[model samples]
Target: MKKRFRILVTGSAGFIGHHLMLALQRAGHHTVGLDALNNYYDPKLKFRRLQEQGFNTEEIKYDTLLSNSTLHGSYFIQLDLADAPALQQLFKAQAFDIVINLAAQAGVRHSIDHPEQYVASNLVGFANILECCRRNRIKHLLFASSSSVYGLNQDIPFSTSHRTDEPISFYAATKKANEVMAHSYAHLYSLPITGLRFFTVYGPWGRPDMAYYIFSKAIVEGKPIRIFNYGDMLRDFTYVDDVVEGVMQLLDVKPATGKAPYKLYNIGNNQPEQLMEAVAILERLLQRKAKLDLHPIQPGDVRATFADVEDLALETGFKPQTSLREGLSKFIDWFKMYHKINEVHALQEG
Candidate 1:
């Protein structure tokens, strides 16, 4: 029988974090979710995600546990990772069996403008997490890396073995730094750590800042949707469920003791989709037309991203399986409902 472990999922209000928290709860684990609930995009959306996980957003206070009514053995707290003392207290109190560090300032473009946010959250916050894990003697620590780390490689399918020193964006650089930092901790502290290099994950309750969500909104509102690199980008769009499944599977599979006690894998769909193709599918799903504003690729943007999931498959016996059309359809359905969009008006008026 599989052991029921106590787990901590940082960034629990975020997209992947929310889905992963629910999955862990369903698997009968005692789960504690923590999020700073920053205003990078919208705090309301983050609160909504917390609410979905049975947290009372109105009653939430920092460093306080909000028990879940619907899901037993689940709890949440609003806390910042940058607060070392608070984080230390939480780690001491919870003594989690596993820690999944998903808390970080996301978005390459946003990082270009707000480098300080990236440094504080991605670097400092992550350092705090590592310290806590080491102090608590956590059994396993799984953190989110990014496909962006493969910047300027020109490799068709980015592999864990490939060189990643030349990150094109500040965001990617921070993630790359995370990989090396975690490795150092693993080597020194003998902590079992795994870094998941996630591809373009999307689904219901995804971040509004993503290209698909933004394009969907603009298309429905009859506003112009900007296509970067003249719609000549490629992405390995992995679905949320698939990503969650991979994480769940790897939860029990910790790194070996002798091999630096650390490992990295690309959790992505092996298939890459063209940018225009994805937009077309979204248009079809929404039954709307998009005003294309073709432009050169913005700074900090990559021309393509394709994940080499061979290592992931070998390690976890899983790979992302959701097709782009199916995933986008689910996202569109959720988007309309979340935005309270009337289908008739959205299609005909736009």
Candidate 2:
């Protein structure tokens, strides 16, 4: 019989967190979701994700806990991690066994202009999480790190052992800081921590800020899509499902007891695809050619990103198996439905 424990997934309204919550519930684990639901993108999509969990968020207020009606033992709260007192109180009341901190101010370029957001959520918020986990005696803590930590790196496949000190963006700096901070906590408090360095995670219900999502919208709207780095970008583009799977498999696989009870692994497709190639796939799927607006690389953006997920595979007997075309196809399926932008091409008799 598989042992099921109560898991707290922050950013539960987020793309990957939402998927992971369902997966955990499927595995018979009690889940609690926490998201600020700020207008980072659109609260409508976030609330829609919550509703998928059977939550009625119309009257739901901040720092309030609401249980899901359909899914038993599932709950959600609109709370920010930076709210230290509230977070600590929740951890106390919930007595969570495992904590997955996926909530963070995401975006590489956005972080350049909005460093305070990153600091509040990624720095202060993360510190609050660590403190709570330590006091609550949580079994294991798994936090989402990003491939952005490998910023300005020429390494083809970014390994956990690779030098990560030279981050090019404020976002990357925050993530790198997270890894270091996690290591310190794990070392001191003996709290087991696993840092997941995720590659370009993409799929259905993905972040609208992502390039693929933007491409889909622009393709459907007959608008020009920005192709940064003059179409020379490369990314592993790991599917969200693959990332959720990796997290599930590693839920019970806690770090070692001795020394720093911490581990870091890259969760990626291991197959880097070109930026133009992804756009081409989107064009093929939407049945509309993308008007490319090639431009120089943006500040706080890398030319390429690839992951060395051997450690993840070695730890758990799995690696990302979703192909880029298949993943993009699935995303577009949801995109059309969500955005309601189905191709209305007419086949008039010629």
Candidate 3:
């Protein structure tokens, strides 16, 4: 029988976190969601996702209560991870069984511009979370790591065992730092921890900063989309639903003996798609061609990423099965519906 206890999901307003909360609620697990809900992206999109899950923004502080949904013990809280005292207070108030740390400063390019935000959210904020977990004696801690940690390695399929000493971006470096930090805590405090290295994650209610979403926006607005690296970059674009499924499967199962209760896995489609190829699929789905301005690759960027999911399969029997075409179609359909862009436009001139 699965153990049922109060679960805390930081970054509940995020694309993955929101979906995970819904999945947890459907499975009858009590959950608490905490997110800063900052204007990093469009806050309206986050609010809409929360609304679908039966959370009213005005009421809850550290957590929001579910009113009409099947979730009997689910709540959402607008909180920042940097607030150590607030996090400590929450841990004191609730007896949480698991803590999924998804709240962090995301984006490779943004990290270059604002290093302080990354330090505050990913480093200091994570330190605060670890302290709270140690104090509360939380059972399991699952935190979000990124595939960008793979850096500039020429390895065809990136594996967890690969040397991750090289990180190109501050964002990737921070994620790497998180793994080291987590390992230290797990080793010292005997805390069970799992770090997930996610590839290019995309789907419904996804962040606008992502390539897929940004390209779609540019295509719709008839604006020229910048094809970085002259359309040479490659990414293992995993669908959001598949990511959520893998996370849900791993929720109860923590690290075990000989594994430090601290494990890492590459959560990705395992099929790397070329930059140009993804754009082609998007154009096909939207029935509109993107205005392209091919440019050289920017700094803090890698040429390709492919996840070796052998370890993930061994751990949770988790396999990413979504194809780019199917996933992109779903996202485009939702985007059109959400933005009320009902009619499809003719393909633009090259």
Q: Per-residue lDDT of 8-51 in model 1, one digit per residue for the tens?
A: 99999999999999999888999889999999988889988988
Once superposed on the true structure, which residue ranges of model 1 sit more than 4 Å away at CA? 61-72, 344-350
Per-candidate TM equals 0.95, 0.95, 0.94
lDDT of 2 by residue, 130-214 (tens): 9999998999999999998988778788899999999999999999999999999999999999999999999988998999988
Model 3 ranges with Cα > 4 A deviation: 61-72, 344-350
**Number of the top-ranking candidate, with lDDT as the measure:** 1
Among all windows of 10 consecutive residues in model 2, the one with the lowest summed lDDT is 63-72
What's the ranking of the predictions by lDDT, best on top?
A: 1, 2, 3
Candidate 2 similarity to native, TM-score: 0.95
Tens-digit lDDT track of model 3 for 236-259: 999999999889888878788553
Q: Pick the candidate with the highest TM-score.
A: 1
Cα lDDT over the full model 3:
0.86
Whole-model lDDT, model 2: 0.87
**Which pairs in model 2 have colliding backbones?**
none
Relative to the true structure, how large is the alpha-carbon lDDT of every model?
A: 0.90, 0.87, 0.86
Better of 1 and 2 by lDDT: 1
